[model samples]
Target: MCMAHKSCVSEADSAAAAAALFAWGANSYGQLGLGHKEDVLLPQRLSNFCEPGCIKSVTGGGGHSAAVTGRKAKPSSLLVAKNQGKTCALYITSIGSGNVDVILQRGSPWTAGVLIIISNIRRSSLLPPFMCLVCCILLLYDCPDGGSLFVCGLNKDGQLGLGHTEDVLCFTICKPLLGCPIRQVACGWDFTIMLTVSGSVFQWGTGLASSGRRLCAGQTLPLFLTAKEPSRVMGLEDSTAVCVVAGSDHSASLTDTGELYVWGRNKHGQLASLAAFLLLPQRIDARCFQDEKVTAVWSGWTHLVAQTETGKVFTWGRADYGQLGRRLESPEGQKPHKQDSQLTFWRPQSSVSLPLCCLTGAAKISCGSEHNLAVISDKCFSWGWNEHGMCGDGTESNVWTPSPVQALQSPSRILLVGCGAGHSLALCQLPALSEPCQDVKVIYTLQADTGNPESQNGMNKERNRKERQSVTSTQSNSDRTRNEGP
Candidate 1:
């Protein structure tokens, strides 16, 4: 899977970078982006992305699905926007370096409206002539590449980020995130989490606060009490967030340093805390993950999937639907139940209770409402809810253990997999004739490289030269022995 903050160039070059998008499952609101509202039992190629290398990432929520499309733009481009009715010329330079020096001029004090500069660029510096007045409203997000965000499906709660709650019948540009170069988007039941090129995160739609709990008991609170427009998540300013993920009623963000912060509803202990709600970001205890740096994380409706550097998969939260991908243990001398629906909850009591390891060697993982998909050793494995064949097992039964999706065991290498509420999407790259089964040999590390590309190329060339020399030596030795007739 592509790292949440991967550069557009790297994403396009990836073996799994989605040249075409394939989706199956629920399409009640046309979230499938297939130009129809009918449900698809089998995976079907999305006509919208007929052009190879157009699709970057795919995500969905309760009933809406979205995809990030477009290749990386040229290194730098002059962006022109009207700020406070004064024509502003903004010269953004060195975007590919991840740190940009934005030079804006001829712009007076800003008034209403926020200008979000989204690119796949990195860190940013605001130069002279760029100023926000007392009445000016300006919001800028940075990243390194340029791309478009498209959404289709239910917008009952504005999950599509289109600035309205009307259900979308076809793929539409998310207006709020339109200008910003998006790195990726994570969808919740009624909200959306957007990550920009600059490692900034924004959220919109109804709040993710819990509906079952009152702040102090006997107190009533509004069900949807969050931003209607995209708002930056405040606490994340301290650290650059590389990845953002969302559950049915909660969300989480991961920093480049491997810190995971969670918020929203905790009714099912999805936040790893006993509190009923977390209005702000809170760090999950490292001990819960065995004190290992979590390299990646994915979420279901009420469960979470985390992978460590060692590729061990850790899971927590609701397990009734077999979403946890592990068997629940009972008290001493008591046997675990055969049926998962009645199993005890896997709530972590502080850091004392740790999340259980479901599987190992998971290179990447994606979670649906109650199902998960992982690419292990170049093959895809699935578990949990199979109703609607979201697990891609050609069955409607819930999967109790990690099982290989026979349909995905193809000659093409599985580059990445994504899951919506009741559907699945896989980004694969077919093998070239020159390199047979090269997908198995090349591991998708998904880690961002900060080194110079030229230097990397030089290293690759050196390694290839050594490999050729070794091959030639072996062949020469074989020939010499054959000539000696010994």
Candidate 2:
């Protein structure tokens, strides 16, 4: 997914010059689009880009990468957020024109406009070495001439929405959505969700309610689906959704009026409860927010993070990985057990306790498989799994509370931070180079400070100049003596 995934864009027009792309990190499945599968510690530039346009968005998930290209003014599709399935394969879904945009410079990889990659896995064992999964749900809002949706990757279930059971090597348009102009899309463990411009929501793919023996009466698998087509979700028939986000097994959406609805799996309180899974969209009780209007919400594999119009953050669900930003420590070295009554909260609760110390200034936040990151007044802060140094903190220690990524402080005033499975991504600004240039100027001035005797170089140069001037005057005087006084 995004851990194995990286993406970039060029502000310049490709017709005048080629768009550049840069990628680094785990590339075992060719998620980096480097022509071969290999892990790179340094950011490498990629050449496989669509000509004549600029990159709108890029997404990587489950070891696969997808990019969207469009005009600068167009409402572009969502890039991949990085999510993996049991197959352990790469799924690349480009939701724009057949052409794509991925740019990278030769020496500069962490440039401006770089989005964080998000990748994750089902409860499986065939994963890479990175701990903590970052949910890389493919959010492709592809709108071509016909504005059809396309998806490809491992399709054990019809998660690709191609109306077929086979895995596709290339993007295959969903025949069922020929004329529907989709505006937003998000993916979960094996399902895809999107909100059309007409304010309709649709979904396709497998859910646990259908995969089990007791088919939940009306739902079944090859479960919770009838065919590999984008079917309208009747549960949201009357709701006008603005955007949607898919967790590993659940989904969350916000309405134009700041209303939030959630559905699908809720095993670890992913849907706001530990009791059972949500089969359809259900409006969460207003009491969860003390009646505050919610502006946005996001779901991780087992935890949920939400934001209110007032700029406060609330979290609930799993607290095992310190993802909840709270201390769920067990005795000594013992690992925390899920469903531990004391550790697990069955309701939407406040953040890891307020006055969040280092992260008190968090403006926006996102959830990874087991970590969190946020943008705070131009700085990036993080907590949870730092096993892969994903926190950018220059250490591998797990942070139970919010902390600043000291390594990204000085030259990097981060604009955004993306948390992926066992890795983290960020978009930081390139501050003005005038500072370094000014430093050089200062050095030059010091060398010319002959007024100070301590300035050895300056003093020597002054002495040499005087000696030359004195010798010139003596030579002139001697010439006059020979021509006139003689």
Tell me the TM-score of each prediction against the true structure.
0.55, 0.62
Cα lDDT of model 2 by residue, 215-323, tens digit = 2455443323444567777667777888888777677788877878887766566565433656667787666665777787777667777776777776666666667
lDDT of each: 0.56, 0.52
- Model 2 TM-score is 0.62
lDDT at residue 8 of model 1 (Cα atoms) = 30
Per-residue lDDT tens digits of candidate 1, residues 1-486?
000011132333344433444566655555566666665544555543334344455555445454433343221222334456653333211111112222333442322112221211111121112111101012333312254455554556566566676765443445666567666676665677778888998887764533534553554433333565677887788888889887767889988888889888876667877677776678887776778888888877788888777777778777666777765564331232222477564444321224445467776788877788888887777778766656654445677667665544456567678776666777666443333232222221212461324323433543465568779999999999999995
The C-alpha stretches of model 1 lying farther than 4 A from their native spots are 1-55, 59-185, 192-206, 209-226, 229-237, 330-359, 430-486
CA shift at 327, candidate 2, in angstroms?
A: 2.5
- Best candidate per lDDT, number? 1
Q: After superposition, how far is residue 448 of candidate 2 from its true place, in Å?
A: 38
